[model samples]
Target: MKKNTLFVFALFIFYFSFCLTTVAQTRSREDYEKLGHVVWEVDTKEKIVAITFDDGPHPVFTPQILYILAKYNAKATFFVAGNKVKRFPSVLERIAKEGHEIANHTYNHIINRNITSSTLHSELEQTDEIIQSIIGYKPTLYRPVGGMHNDLIINTAVKNGKLVILWSWHLDAEDWKNPAASQISRHITKGIRPGNIVLLHDWIGTEYSRTSQTVKGLETTLRFLYQNGYECVTVSELLFRSEIIDQDYFNTFPIE
Candidate 1:
């Protein structure tokens, strides 16, 4: 009886230690991201990356992007705004029909910093409804405007069964700034690597500069990625993860 009791106590201690380790890693491990609040990038060595656009369904730029993507046979993820999707459901349908991923970018591209729970949920649901109405389903990825998020946004989004996403700060093309096309292309193509998620824009924003520059940058960026044999995939495909194990430090999840 004494020996059996000792064995049971040992097993309990091992289990307790394991749990503690897991909890610690979850809180403090920048090395591992198994998808909760946000997945900035994926933990993989594959020579693939995701090219994502946000805040759009632009009548002009979206079609141009689609043509470019089709030319390369590349699949991209688009985080579309609800109002814009409502305005251009046919474009969203074309995006889906072309085998691109249509994700949620909220209703109006509002900042996620102090929005109420009800507002957040409403935005998400309304956007989702618009997307579903067009594409027959909604995407699981949720990216807030400007890559901003707080606990409220994360928790609310997770509760709604969606994963929050961000992109590499360095990989952002800054197309929204209406920079020169060559500058945007050079900024992205410099030192590109596997598992990088590049944030771009397809929104026209009432100016030809934004649309024209983004399209030009995209054409150059795609050519660069193609010449180097890099496959531009969807964000969900880039983040193809497996179960976490003992000791591995993947350069994903760049959260502070």
Candidate 2:
């Protein structure tokens, strides 16, 4: 009887997990926009793309990524964690000095979905304070760690005066896994469109140094954009070029 019951419980858990995945896969971008001031991509026709990096300010990889950006004359956004900022202030300073957008990714890189409101607020506030101390201003953008968020996360971020920035659903380079540079570059350059935000990582924590692969991939991706006549700009620049401030601006377009 005990064995039979355990089998049933396992089946129940599997079913529940499958249902969650199905719902996430089926939800359209329009559905996500209804949640809050969330931005996945800018609605525009200009030949521009926003290349954004997350979990950065690494002393080694961040500078390498910056060097490549400079070589290509491209501007990208960097979403940094507070703990990292404290550890690497000079790297953070260089990111700002090099003319890239610096946004918050939380204090400790927390990704718990059931995080309490107070904890979430502290995470954001602490990161904001750290970033402002270095950059002289609080960032207007916040990306939840692991790209996971909910109503509470969205509401809290909005209350704190930030737009929850996410990448184009199709532009995730998945470099954290240490994929080859060629695969990373192709995933971004293929089917590339205007106002698309490309997600890359300049830091993947001390456990691994996968960003070494990312440094190679970035140059190839930038070269493809340059040759294709696409300007690589910051996320804020992309938003301004699209002129989309209203939260409902996404509703005007058909679901992709």
Candidate 3:
């Protein structure tokens, strides 16, 4: 009887694991479709660009980034993590106080794509609340960790009133790898054009040497945008160009 009970327990574990995996994957294909359709870039003829930093509000690195942006008189968006904001409310305060946009990057920077429903729901709310507490307003933009999201995650966020933000593939700076700042500057400014959204990481969770390198590269990048006559604006402002008057924010228009 003991052996039979043990066998049943193992079977139950297998069944539960299978169900979880299936649920996670079932919405994934639909999620991929919706994800591709979401705003990857905006249509505008203005010489303006959007610079977005993800996974940030780091106590040290974030302040460094803010200094560079302020020096150049540029405006950009920060997609901050909830837990990070909780620990570094002052950093978020400085971001808002300085006139930069703060958006949601999730409460915990979960890289795993197979997140449970409860975890996804909690992540959205926790981060939103933390940001609201710090900035006095909830964010309307959400960028998933590493740009990974399924149908459930997208629908949940949209239902909760967030327009998912995804960057163009050709425009990523990939500073998370800690390459020389010169390399990062080139990746972003090379062939950079209007209405293009460039991705960079401000907070990589640890205050590493390479992370500092990304910060170092930021000045050169802002300089490029400044000299090139491209106005560095928040992702929301990028959509606010004359052709698209007003904050056409969280627009459901997909890639044509």
Clashes of each: 0, 0, 1
Give the top-scoring candidate (TM-score): 2
Comparing 1 and 2 by TM-score, which wins?
2
Ranking of all predicted structures according to TM-score, beginning with the best and ending with the worst:
2, 3, 1
Off by over 4 Å in 1: 1-35, 207-211, 241-256
Off by over 4 Å in 2: 1-28, 34-36, 205-211, 246-256
The parts of candidate 3 lying over 4 Å away from their true place are 1-37, 205-211, 242-256
List clashing residue pairs in candidate 3.
31-151
Write down the TM-score of every candidate. Answer: 0.80, 0.83, 0.82
Q: Report the candidate with higher lDDT, 2 versus 3.
A: 2
Worst lDDT window (10 residues) for model 3? 24-33
By summed lDDT, which 10 consecutive residues of candidate 1 come out lowest? Answer: 242-251
Give each model's whole-structure lDDT.
0.79, 0.84, 0.79
* Candidate ordering by lDDT (highest first): 2, 3, 1
Candidate 1: residue pairs that collide: none
